[model samples]
Target: MTTSALSAPPLHSSAHDDNVPNGEDQAQRAAELAALHRAADAGEEAAAWVRQLAGRQGEEEHGRLLERVAEAIVKASSREIIPGSDGLLTEELRYTLAADVVLGASHTTGTLPELHPGERMPLIAVCSIAATLPSCVLGDLVREVEVLAAEMEAATDAGRAAELPAAG
Candidate 1:
């Protein structure tokens, strides 16, 4: 009788069909995830392009656009996330501000206009979160944003190169 430790049966049998190749499902899933990531990345680029165009128009216009976008995000998540339970600006509201409120003069405006109930919560939340960010973290965040911008730029260049006709 031959003794071999390598002959041990697998601890669990695969639920998939026997003829189906291994890693095919995982490869498909990976491709799907990559597609989703690419779509999201393209969306971010589109938003930044819009922001840049707005900024080119004027500071006031850009600021207003930022405020509107932030407002939309906050309003969308109001009932489920913000709830207005702890006054108007809750922690959740602050987090939304962090992600959505990049451009604007709302931070400079110290006094907030009186808002009825849920109104202006987004603006208030934005200014509050902007004011709360530590200087060091803000610096780091700016650096990271720059890095991401460079990466996106490189990716765009690579894609354009791929699309161009080969020289004779």
Candidate 2:
């Protein structure tokens, strides 16, 4: 691809008037997406990796959890698209939500127990995957965060509480 297709010069990045996707960034984003997909879907192998990453488990269940979380995240992300407004992009993108969930929430408060020979290691590669990318994919990422926030909540008022249902 031509250089022009890759970037609009650094000066233009602040100007969102153009709706075109950056070729270079797109390529990078694609690769990042693939890596996240792999990291999440590696299943038990991922679990063991998470344990080591979290300092919770050993090397045995890494692949397993990796696969589960990655696969789940992908499924969750790919399921929806935030209806664009006036045909312009915004923070409703999954990438944004993902980055917040994995990097912000999981990294902050997800360390837990039972990584012996077989256990869940507070795996959040999918979240990390989302967290690492740009904020363009937030709609997909939001679902994950919402789910996690729901799970981590204690009693009725702790953690990120779920939104109340809309009134008719």
Candidate 3:
């Protein structure tokens, strides 16, 4: 799977520069905010996709998938991180973040956003979960979900085919 790099918006720096113009700083801040909004939107879409995939499975199968996800999370989290890497997030943190999103999205009520109380997680919520994660992690998470979805679909189709009477 191709890992697409996601550019996160720059965090606001506390230091004030006397030499820089105020207007330019304001414009830059606005741009950064826009980038963050875009990232949040992307994260929400990814969550929805995973939820859909989970919805296709039976209860037992869904439970199995969740188990697999848990196992994956544990494995991913146990890996050692390289010292002084350029990545803003470590592999463990990324996996944990992705797992949180995936688990929340895969909840039974997570597919529908219109319900009051039980509503699917809002974009803001998803953004909060993904705020620190880089785009590559989201991309990887989506790719893995897609693979699982495909496998589930194929298995379902095969079962159906087996149930049908053989063509005379």
TM-score of each: 0.29, 0.22, 0.34
The TM-score of candidate 2 is 0.22
Name the candidate, 1 or 2, with the larger lDDT value: 1
- Tell me the lDDT of model 1 at 21: 39
Ranking by lDDT: 1, 3, 2
How well is each residue in 1-168 modelled by candidate 3, as lDDT tens digits? 654444433345335756443777777556544443444444434444334434444554453453443333232222211123342455544544452443443466444222222222332233233423333234443343334334333433443344356789
| Comparison by TM-score, 2 against 3, better one | 3
lDDT of 1 by residue, 57-154 (tens): 34464445554543433232222222113224345545544543443344555422222233233333333423232221233333432343344435
Residue 94 alpha-carbon offset, candidate 2, angstroms: 21
lDDT value for candidate 1? 0.39
The parts of candidate 2 lying over 4 Å away from their true place are 1-17, 44-168
Report lDDT per candidate: 0.39, 0.36, 0.39
TM-score, candidate 1, is 0.29
- The C-alpha RMSD of each candidate to the native structure, in angstroms, is 16.9, 15.5, 15.6
**Cα lDDT for residue 68, model 3?**
42
Scored against the true structure, residue 110 in model 3 reaches a CA lDDT of 47
Q: Cα miss at 4, model 1 (Å)?
A: 30
